[model samples]
Target: MENKLKFSQKHPLLFGFALILTAMVLIIGAMAVFNFFFFKAHRNSFFGTKVGVVHINGLIADSLRITNWIDELAKDNAIKGVIVRINSPGGVVGPSQEIYAALQALARKKKVVASMGSVAASGGYYIACAAHKIVANPGTLTASIGVKAKLTNMQGLMQKLGIAEQTVTSGKLKNAGTIFRPLTPEEKKYFQSLVNDMHDQFVQDVARGRHMDIEKVRALADGRAMTGRQAKEAGLVDELGGFNKSLDVLRLLTGIKGEISLVQGPPEKSSLLEKFLGKLTFKEQILGPRWVFTYE
Candidate 1:
């Protein structure tokens, strides 16, 4: 009764190939699930005393935000400590304060540390002031305690191009920096007051953060950059050492024995992309030292 030469029985090789393909798909799927967990688990490191390096490696503009990164450190219980590594020229007033506030808030939950890079001046130091401790290299450039407002007077350019600007406002200061006209005395006084007030705030914040006298911080915060060793002398920083030394302090403070994880505002690999983009706009190129997220 030579009945059943079943289809799969007759062609075992085909069945074997199907089984192999199914096994491979399942394996790949399992790996993808594992990867998802791995990434999510590492995120906890940001909040722990895990020595996460927050790189502020650019201009100190009001728009360049760093608060979001700090917020991450705030929430991560494993991130018991933080190291804000800064290298910037100290940008405008408003943005720098935003970063300082984020650090201040984060400090409530965890100890924050500052690790200055090649440069940490003006707004960079402003951002660093919020940290409980500041570390820098012997040649680190830190300090730039002042406020600045850029005024581009394009009145002549507008006249040359025969461009006329029309405006009607309820307030006299509404069009203070309008490109069509030069600044008036009233406008000058108004803008100067704003800059001066921000400078005073900067000095006060520094003095309070470093536990130095307001007058002393005022003297050193003359919008001038300083070497790390010199900064240590002036009480701007606690010690003269690189990031490793900062990590040692972090380890002592938090007692975490894991590899340092760096969570920067923007990735360094994107720097080349920045250069190409920077050529198109002056605002885009300036490195800012400020907290980024409004509520990160």
Candidate 2:
């Protein structure tokens, strides 16, 4: 008994240290569990005030997901406003126009601010017009207000490689943009007409959103890109500033007082192999060789 008492007395500090460590571990574990459940449910609300932030990065191939996010934010009472951060050269005409339309709908309910990043040109800028205000850095590349259909003729390449492709289609226009052969003059005119019609639609949307004269917007919609500074001068952008500036504008427009919490959409998850290969690839993976009506 005396020997045991002596050992206990001598190691009292160690015993206390171990007890504290055990308590800390239990507390940390509890916190982890609580956070996992509670925060996941209340992810959209932070502290008290909440502002939804949607990031439009990379090539905009589709708008369904983003439009859904905007719709959710618009309906959420906690979400006061939305900030759309865009960094894209542009992508398919349909997707871009769809996103722009969704943003316009969202803006009708809540104040929407667009924050332009390094390369918000073409479809990127097209979508930005739907916002209540646009903020961009002075040096940011933007205002590629045009549409293009990229068609690649690989017939010579296939010939060199001793390859040939045969196709059966319902109509001549069905194979109009095929890469197997060069476009005939008639095909070229048909495609050009399609591009021109889409371009006119783009200009109309921009003019409607920016509240500018349609003719004015048309004058600047000649497939020419411009820097943010130039865009601001041309009245394409409302303000010349970065992300923070955009937030400030949104705060004022939304009448948000005190601290604010920004809730952004969850980033798309990618596999480990995809992440690894993406880093090594020189060019971005295209959906396919389909004719892309893009602003790039």
Candidate 3:
């Protein structure tokens, strides 16, 4: 020890560099240990069965994260079931369908339950239909089964501002949904047909997911939002309850006498700019061009 102290005194700079390197190694090791335990706690338990949770919060603008969560839960043998907790008014059609599809695939491997929060309608309900069963609070707003595309005519505003612009397209319908002017009759019909087709697809998926007849679903798929109780009465929801009720149903489905641990995906990380803007810049609010159709 005296010789090491003498050596350190003779090479203080080298000793300081070695101390920093040792400190860094210790910190890295501590972080690794912490991450390991954290991941284990979230994914499984040493003494209980596990149930994974997939959160669908706010607008359903993107499916990659949600789908990846579902897929991870599906591959995890420790996860006997999954709960999809939804608190959204819905969003774009493509992402909603993707989430639904991912849930459906996961359902085949494990029991899946949908739990609706305050507002789970339109695309939210669409995704829930893919679950084995759905539970919603009686007062939850849900089941707005329809598609819509909003278009704005900026011609008058532009005229008032004395702004003029022109665009050239290969086809007459190429700019059918441009905000510069009102749509022509033909363009209107074309867009209407598109909306109708998407709406029909929504109804079909709902009917299939809920195991209800197509005609029965059509009766309730009028683009009007319904309360959870109303949806239950209309055969759109499997049960009328909240998150705990859904967990109970999951327990019943899994039939695990042992304790059940809930696992959830990692929280999403946001950039400093996104944090500053908050949800005002959520992807759902500004996802696409004027012609983009949505399940909102």
Q: Best candidate per lDDT, number?
A: 3
lDDT of 3 by residue, 163-197 (tens): 87698999999889887788999999999999999
State the lDDT of candidate 2 residue by residue for 1-296, as single tens digits: 99867867899988688789999999989977787687865533436578889999888776666888878888898889999999998877878888898888899999999999998999999999999999999999998889888888999998999888888999888889888789999999999999999999999999999999999999999988899999999999989999989989998898988766788873553688865665444133244655767755
**Sort by TM-score, best first: what order?**
3, 2, 1
In model 3, where do residues sit more than 4 Å from their true spots? 1-47, 270-288
lDDT of 2 at 135: 95
The TM-scores, one per candidate, come to 0.72, 0.79, 0.82
Summarize candidate 1's per-residue lDDT along 1-296 as a digit string, tens digits. 23334756888798789889999999988877775577655544333335556788666543333676777768777656778888786665667788899889988888788988888888888889999999989898778677766666787898899998889999999878766777899998988887777788888999989999999988886677788998899999997888879888777777777555655453443577776555444344342311111100
Let me know the TM-score candidate 2 reaches against the reference structure: 0.79
